[model samples]
Structures are given as C-alpha cells and as structure tokens.
Target: MSRTTALDPLFTAVDTAAFTDRHLANLAAGTLAAVRVPDFLGNAACRAALSALDRLPTTDYDPGRVPTPIVRFGPALNDYRDQDGHLDAERYWRDAEAARVAWHRAALRPDPIAVSMGHLSAAWGAALAPATINGRAVFGGTLREINAGALIHYDDINREYPTGLFDQEVIAQLAFNVWVAVPPTGGATTVWRHRWEPADDHHRQAYGYRSETVEHCQHVTLTPKLGDGLLFNPANFHAVEPNPDGRRIAFAFFLGLTTTGQLITWS
Candidate 1:
C-alpha cells in the first residue's frame, strides 16, 4: 500500500472568514483591528523570491539605533517647540544614511528600496501646512520602503524567549507590513503575545500606555510557500518567528499613509 502525505497548511487555501469575528470584536473593544490579503503574490513568484532570500546573510545589531529614531523626524507639527525651533535636517539625513548602510550589510542585498527624496519633499510640503493632531497643529509625514534582503527575526540566545522584537516601535510610522513567502521547506514567521487579559494585576497598575487596553498580541509565522503573503497593522503587538528550515526567504515592505481625510479623484 502506498502512503499519502498530509499537505502542509501553507499550501492550503486559508478561509478569509477565519478571523473576521475576532477582528471586528477587537475593533469595537478599542484594542486593534487587522485585515489580511491572501495569495498576495502568485505561487511561482513567491517560490522564486524565497529561494533567493535564503542565500542572503543575516547580521545582528541594536534594534534601537536602526531605521533612525522617531524624534529625528522632527517634532510633531503640533509640538510645543517654537516655529523657529532648531531643526536638524543634516543629523536626520546622516542617521538615515547610516541605517540604510547597516540594513544593506545585514541583509547582504544591494539596492533596497528607500524613502525617496520625493517622499521627503512631500513631507516638507505637508509640514508647511499645519495639520491637527489631538486638536493641535501637527507636522507629520509617512513613508514606506522595502527591505529586499531583510532578516525578519533572530533567535536570541540571551533571552528566555527564543524570539526577539527586532522591528518594533522603531518603524511605527510605517503602518503596514507586507511579507512575501517563498516555498519548498520554508518555515513560517511566528507572532506571539502573553495571552492578553484586560483584568490582570499587571493591567490594573499600569499608567500612561496600558497593556490592558491591548486586547491581544500575536506572533506571526511566515512559512515559505508559493503565493503566501501577510499584511497587518504594525502598531499592534506582533513578532516574526524564526524560519527553522532555512528554506524560507521573504521580501518585506513597509507602508505608510496619512492619518486623516479621504481621497476623491474625478475623471
């Protein structure tokens, strides 16, 4: 008798309704909400990309200093700083350049996508016209860029948990995260949480930002399989699980968008 192998979940078609109820409930409870785009990349392309990514190098560094700091983007236009406050464009540029170099070296991929000068220019224009945040004038710009050869996670030997949140808070401005999964023995990225509870002792004693308010956090597993991709809200708690098989490779792209208003284009 011939044995039949069970198919991997990665190759199965995920039910879109799987998390619909959970997503809506979270949004209503003021925790967080998310949407997913299945089959984000075609099967063949996803496989090819993952195969390429496997060959890249993975370097370690302090996540704090990476991608530049939020403060460097300049005070929120609504911040208490004076109109003529000292703005250090040079410093910001230097930091950005350093980040780019470090990112490229770690991934061993040349020509990663970046926030173009056009993006900066658009930001400057937006800054000139004060926008409101928390009922105060604010200057804010969002930019999205790609990291072709990016290591999504690293197994931290020093920590009790094998995983690390290498890309947290640092890239908050990028509201969306996209990962393309390639196949044939690729491991999935895992996202984790402490099983969020609103009534825990830890939740009750918190001040400023409270984890209690956070409904739940999740760990994502990006398994290598043709036509697999994930998109999620980054402000929420999340992490990527290490690819165990070493066959999984991915290209992650960060996306940003304005916080206010709707677009209307007439033809």
Candidate 2:
C-alpha cells in the first residue's frame, strides 16, 4: 500500500473527539483497555526505514539473567565481555543507551516520519492524568532509540508501572511505541504463548484471566503487510514475538499526569 493509503485505516478506526470521551470514562472507572493504532507509519516511510535498518548492525542479546522474562534482540547490549570474559551489566547498558541516542539523532533528521502520537491522550487517559488516579507527582516525555521486548506475568510481585526500578508508569505516560510492517517478508515482533499446564484445583482464578492448558497452547501469527500495524496497552499481558522474516521496527514513549489525574499509555 502507498503511504497515503496506509494511514486511512488508522484514522478511520479512531475518531478523536469520541476517543477522548471514552478515555475520560475509562479513567473514572479505573479500567484498562488496549488501544491499537494500525498502520501508524506510512508505506513509503516504512520501506525507507527498513532499507536503512538493513544497512545497520543487527541487535545483540544478553546471555545473563535480567529482571524481565522477555527476550531481546537489538544493537544495544546489557553487558560486555573483556579479553578475560568478564562482564559488567551497568557498563553494557550505558554503552547501549549512548549508542541508541546517537542513532536516534541521526534517524530522526532529514526524513523524520516514523511514529505518531495521535491517540495518546484518548487511549491512555490515566497515564496522562496520574494525579487524578493516584495522589502523587507524575512526569511525561519522550525517549528515542530505546527498543525493548517485555513480558508481563500476572503472578509477579511488586510490578508497579510508575514506581518500580524500571518506572513502567513513566514509560507508559510517554506513549513510546511506533510500529511498521514491511513487504513480502514477515518481520519479527510476533506475540506468542508458552506451553504450560493448568494450575492445580486449589489455585484460584479470575474472570477474563485463566491458565492455559499445556496441550492446548494457542499461537497467533502476525504477518507483516502494507497496511498492518498494532497499538495496544503497554502494561497488558503480552509479548513481542521476534520477527522471523524481515525487520519490523516500532517506536515507544512514555506519558504521565499528576496523581489526581488519569494517565494514558498506548502503542
């Protein structure tokens, strides 16, 4: 699809005014919903970016342990090995962050048309107005070149978005992610479910949330196409399945409001 045609479905699905109203309502009720902005980047831009990415270095993954459960493949590294094979996670993350900053500066110039913040407030009202939802200070802004893969387990403890070490709350407030799908080759960024058995009878379960049977695991295959992009709640229980064929690129940011207000964070 042409760049012009790619943006049609996204604009059609979201009506700015109506979305704002619903956002306010959801904020009042304290219910979370995933908001998807499909085909965010136009076809022409996506093609150009993918071509550029092909010439760039491939992302590397860390072999050591990390706090999160998801796997990551990016140019950034969490640690590096010296001649003696020693590793330092802090230095690795710093170097990666620095490289990311430089790359972003170069990519955002000359032709800066990759991501959009159109549905930020409407889809992520609470993230935008944290003061209303919780009595605390909130911050909002954007970060560039930091790509990540995350997995949110329902049973994990101390997984607060805004306050933990990672500051998920801040991340959400920024509305950091932008997505693009390229050509006949389906890129990485697939979401999947791990094979697991049903919990014991004593384990309690909540509605809309159930354990999956080991033998009945489900996998949703997302193919990269001319007019396909997905935006959803970042805090939702999901995973960024790797791109198997071509390269699939997405951008992410954070959005925040005061404690008394609502915050809105979406893809």
Candidate 3:
C-alpha cells in the first residue's frame, strides 16, 4: 500500500452479525475503526465461562508498571518483556505452561477462545495460527477484569520488539475482545483516531499516555454488553472507562495479518 495524500475521514464503528473478511481487511487497511458483534457468544456459554473463572488463577499486573488495578488470568507476552525489550523467555514459558494447565482445569464449556478463533478463521477463510518464536507457539487469549479501567494506550508488536519477537512477520495488527460479563453502567471502550507520535512522549504515564495525548483526535466509544465481541486496530490510542457497578470482564487477544495473507494470534 502506498501513502496517498488523501485526508481520509476518522474511522467509525460497525455492528455486524458475523466477522467477515471485509471487516478484517478494512481494519488492517485503516479503513474501519471497529467491528462489533452483539451476543457473539451464547448467553449460556458466557455464563459458563464466567463460572469457570472462579477456579482459574488470576493475578494483578505489577503496580510499579501498571498503576491501574486490573485483574487478569492467562499469560500475556507483553507482561513478560524485559527492560531491554527482549522477552523473559524462562519465566514467560513457565507461566504459559501453568496457565494452559489452569485453563484446562477450569474446563469452560464451549471454550471462549476456541469459539472466537473459529469465527475469525471462518471470516478470513483461513485457519488462524498461533504466533511462534523459535518455532514455539506463543500463548493466545487472556481473561481480564477491567472494572477499574485501562489507561489510554496503543499496541504495536513491531515497535515493542523492534528486533522482532515472532517468527512470522506482521504487516498489521488488530485487537479482539469478547465480553463474558459486563457492568450495568460505564466500562465503555474508547478508541481515538490517534497513533503514537514522537511528541506524544511528553504525556507518557506508566504503560499508557495521558488523555491529552488524544484530546484533539476524533474517536468512537462502545459500551460493552455481555457476549459482545469487538475487533479493532490497537495501533490507535484507546482506553476503557471505569465501571464501579459490577465486574467487567473479557477474553482478549491480538491478531496479526502477515505478509503471506495469513492471520496469526497471541495474547
């Protein structure tokens, strides 16, 4: 894709019954802001996943790194990154294995991750593969309870691991989230039309940026509903609003579109 001098409109959100190839393609190409599927997971399945949450081991992110009090289950590679931007392979793999065991033990009927991946694969007309490094598959999907909310941030694997972390090269990346539980009010996710710029560094705060970083950018906000699935490009600065009424939880992962037209996944 060549850079055109066109002033494209800021991206907007769409509600769809299914994840379609057009949705995936538009997201990667920056032509769409987000695609949302209401009730992507059946109500019974969502309840089952929520129930299984009790048996799974959940942890909080390091307070020093992430001031927000977000609770999480499953392993995310970003959490195991070293100061030098390299992965702490030993500890990451250890937790990865433990998480796998715990997930199986939870035995969530109609595994949320599996079902989400299946729908995505069907939409793309290709099987989704796990992102690998050194020929080892990386962990995919994480369950997060974000009642207190997340700070404004963006995610780009290329920038995070400049030398490369995955064996597969990614041209573009998108974030996927499926809500199993939601609060009565608040907990809306807002995605700005902004991507990180060098000058934005001045507004840095912990693992994210200050709201001022995107104050001037056009954006869209989506209030999550139980069993709703949302897909969007995380290269845009985004944040989650705090929900004080009830627990707001979701299963999340990243999808990267490779140069070979293949889709790969990871948490």
Global lDDT of each candidate: 0.31, 0.35, 0.93
Each model's TM-score? Answer: 0.36, 0.46, 0.96
* Residue-by-residue lDDT tens digits, candidate 1, 22-68: 44223223244334445545555444444444333334322443331
Best of the candidates, TM-score: 3
By summed lDDT, the worst window of 10 consecutive residues in model 3 runs over 1-10
Which lDDT tens digits does candidate 2 get at residues 1-267?
Answer: 211212212111221222353543342332423333345556676566555654334443332443322222232211244444443445655555554555565464223222344444445432243221133222222222212333322211122321232223332222234444443453433222331224522332321123332113322334434434333332233344333344345544333432435453321
* lDDT agreement of model 1 with the native: 0.31
Give the C-alpha miss distance for residue 247 in model 3, angstroms.
Answer: 0.8
Off by over 4 Å in 1: 1-33, 47-224, 262-267
Best by lDDT: 3
Instruction: Tell me model 3's lDDT, rounded to 2 decimals.
Output: 0.93
Name the candidate, 1 or 2, with the larger TM-score value.
2
lDDT of 3 by residue, 1-267 (tens): 333233347488999999999999999999899999999998999999998898989999889988989999988888877989999999999999999899888888889999999999999999999999999998998999998889999999999988899999999999999999999999999998889989999999999999878776778899999999999999999999998889999999999999999999999
